[model samples]
Target: MKNLLESPPDKLLTALRDILAAKSIVSPAEIAERIALTDAASPAQGARMVARAWTDPDYRALMLHDGAKAAEAAGIPMRGMPPLGVLADTPDLHHLVVCTLCSCYPRAVLGYPPFWFKSAAYRARAVRDPRGLLAEWGTVLPSHMKLTVVDSTADYRWMVLPLRPAGTEGFTEAQLAALVREGDMIGVTLPIASA
Candidate 1:
């Protein structure tokens, strides 16, 4: 029972571990040491890209033209990592992403995807019927924006830099985070405001 409680899904884990130090399977220090976070380069590139896209129309245009090159222009060095690319959500086409084999994500841009994103249901259903999944995520898209699901592999990762939402003219970066839904970044939602 002690070991079973420590398994994930057991809320008692935190309580027991806190009250009984000896019962703790993993120390805070050990957990911290085991965890691996992205380097500064990752978020730095994402921040730079977001700022450029916000302020520079030409840069956004350049990004839409070519993702990899846009990253280079945005001062992101990508040669060391597997090919980093960007996906622009357009009015005519919506892009959703998945890694069928494993979680191949653009950590440099989007950071870590949610736990659900790396789930088997998401990976399987994303490719099976993307539109249905988007609708389930509260995104109702028009027939115009055709949905395209892209699979990220071990050699490559994917990120969805969704289209800027309407009514957000001149909004600051902090404000934009609110408009940018997790589903939108996951490619399961479009940039449509709630009714």
Candidate 2:
């Protein structure tokens, strides 16, 4: 109370919420729940899908057709939303996702979004010209296949879900899953198994 009336702005705001919570105006659990929730599931989920796609053609088809159901079929619950869609990034094609107004993502498939996705530079230009944005990420796609860029507003969020490289054709699901990196899942890069 000593600092609330006459202190500078930063000091007034500092520790302000904690004070309010102590007074029972807002429970600590309430704030924790708000901050702890993520826009999507963790990136590990995407890696699993990609690995399954490489090994099982039927499972792959299911994922591409109905991603949400496919995820639950694989044991990851689709937190709240429905109609999950999986955008596959092929050898010649690339996919990137954005939400112009807000970050709408596939929490069950992709997981929490990276910090860069929320930045002003990414949000502004990703929709206007996605190819340029991919270039900034060092992602180059053949000009022939359309770069399918989806939007994840409140209604949807996306997972990049990278394609498996050629060398690992005989790899088991474990090995295959290892190659799908976070950047690959977000459409920034493709996973190339190291020699």
Candidate 3:
């Protein structure tokens, strides 16, 4: 028998997948479906939603009320995924998301969470010192604006709908989407208007 340890990582994974498929433990189609689902929840899709919200008040309302539904309406496949919550940053309020127990990010909208987002220090500081944490990330909110830190859970995840930056009045949805970054949706940073 060949030593499994001697096989390349990719080769070993492929071999295991083939064995599993042969044993009826899982199928190629199932794996492909899961991969497709995961790919659907990227930052680009989140940006598209944000751009739509900026252009349409109704969509903004729908997104804030029911994120999962809004995502579905925007053609993002979210079957069997947990409910999503969209938080909007108003002039007087800001929202931040973190999973206290673990990294329960809105993968469908933000893809994978950054390494720092999954760190123990970030989880604790995000709740205990949101202002400081935001400052560290170069996101300093107005003194009068309140900061709200929301915890993401297994059943409900959150995505931030950042306030549209000034000087974007004439920009198209695609252009606006270009300005939206993963950090902006995470509330760690705000989108800047391009000159």
Candidate 4:
């Protein structure tokens, strides 16, 4: 018998899908559709949500209160995924997210996790010395600001709502979204206002 652990992920997924299909648990087409949906997802979805939250107090309240609903409201499907939690960065507080065991990310909003986000070094540094990690990413926060590191788990994932950049008061939502990036939503970097 082949060792399942050594099997490629695509092969494993195919085998699992075959088994589920055989059992009538879920059809192959359904699985393919779901995969397509996930593939279509990107950081832009999260950026849109962040921009909306920055410009709309009601949306911001909903995002902070229920991230999954916020994602759905932003038109990103959150069905059959772990719960999402949005951590809002404030002038005095910042949030850093990491999955200590694995790369448990908000894929429904942020698409695939970045390669660095799955690295052991990032996971260790994020929990051990988040400030240092941020510095390495060129995200230097104020010395007086408190940094909180949150763990994203299989049961619950996390995404950051970074503070809106200065000089963006009059920017349109699309413009604000343009300033946000995957790193910003992951809390490794902050959005910078374009001069």
Candidate 5:
């Protein structure tokens, strides 16, 4: 038959899909929609949430409690994606995120992973020596402060909520958001106030 002569990978994929559906694991339609959503997600969506949290204490608490619900409330598409875990950086503690197994980042919130994020070196270094890595990135924490490295996995993704910079008490939400960078959300860098 024509199907028999088709590529083995396609046949394998079809078989896998059928097995998954038969086992009631995940439907093929859901998978397709997830792929579409991933493609549609952008870093700007995450920046908006950060800006809102910076300005709204209630929203910040909600975000820290249930990141998925907060992100949905912010109008970011997360219909079929895994729940996002937001790690907030404080004066005495800092959070860093990395995917040791692979580049399992919060793509729906922070867009595509950077080149270094997917590199083997970064994956190993993040868990091994987070302070050193942060230092290399020009983020030197206080000697008494603590650094926490969080690992992201396939089923769950993580993002960082950087501390709002000082002397910007009057900055509007849009202006605050403009200062947020993709790296800041990923915990690789901090957001600096623009003059």
Candidate 6:
């Protein structure tokens, strides 16, 4: 038999699937459905939610109160996923998210965690020197603002609702979404008015 550990990921997954099937632990159809769901997710889904929240007061309140519901309302699937928490940024405060233990992220909304988000250096620096880390990402905030580092875990994941940029008051939801990036939602960067 080929060594499973040395096999390519595709072969390894096939082998595991065969074993699980033999044991009747899970069905192939279920696995395929999950893979399809994951593949369908992308950062655009999160951007849509952010854009809606930016333009609608009711949506903003709903998002701050229950993030998972807000995401579902925005057309992102939340079933079989952990609860999502949104940290709203304001003039006086900023929020940064990190999974100190592992990369427990809101994949259903944001698609996937960035490589840097899973690095040991990032995890350490995020908690140790958040200001410096943000500065490195060109997200330097004012000295008077409060910066809070929120940890995402298996039980819950966190996303940021960045403050809307000025001079975008007349922008449509789609236009506003165009201005949002994954980094902005991750709190590593801010969304600019000029997309």
Highest TM-score scorer: 6
Report model 6's TM-score to 2 decimal places.
0.91
Candidate 6 residue pairs in clash (backbone atoms < 3 Å): none
lDDT of 6 by residue, 1-195 (tens): 876677899977888999998899988988998999899888888999999999999999999999999999987878999888999999999999999999988898999888999999999999999999999999899999999999875698899999999999889999999999999999999999986
Q: Looking at model 4, which ten-residue stretch has the lowest summed lDDT?
A: 148-157
TM-score of 2: 0.74
lDDT by residue (tens digit), candidate 1, 21-80:
566676766544434334444444554565567567888777766666777786665555
Q: What ordering of candidates by TM-score runs from best to worst?
A: 6, 4, 3, 5, 2, 1
Give the residue spans of candidate 5 off by over 4 A: 1-36
Residue 176 in model 1: shift from native, Å? Answer: 2.9
TM-score per candidate, in order? 0.66, 0.74, 0.88, 0.90, 0.81, 0.91
**What is the C-alpha local distance difference test score of each model?**
0.68, 0.74, 0.91, 0.92, 0.89, 0.92
Give the clashing pairs for model 4. none
Stretches off by above 4 angstroms in model 6 are 1-3, 6-12, 19-24
**Candidate 1, TM-score vs. the true structure?**
0.66
**True-structure RMSD for candidate 2:** 4.9
Q: Residue 62 of candidate 6: its Cα lDDT? A: 97
Among all windows of ten consecutive residues in candidate 5, which has the lowest summed lDDT? 1-10
* lDDT winner, 3 or 5: 3
- lDDT for 78 in candidate 6 is 88
Task: In model 5, state the lDDT of residue 167.
Answer: 72
RMSD, every candidate, angstroms: 7.7, 4.9, 2.5, 2.4, 4.1, 1.9
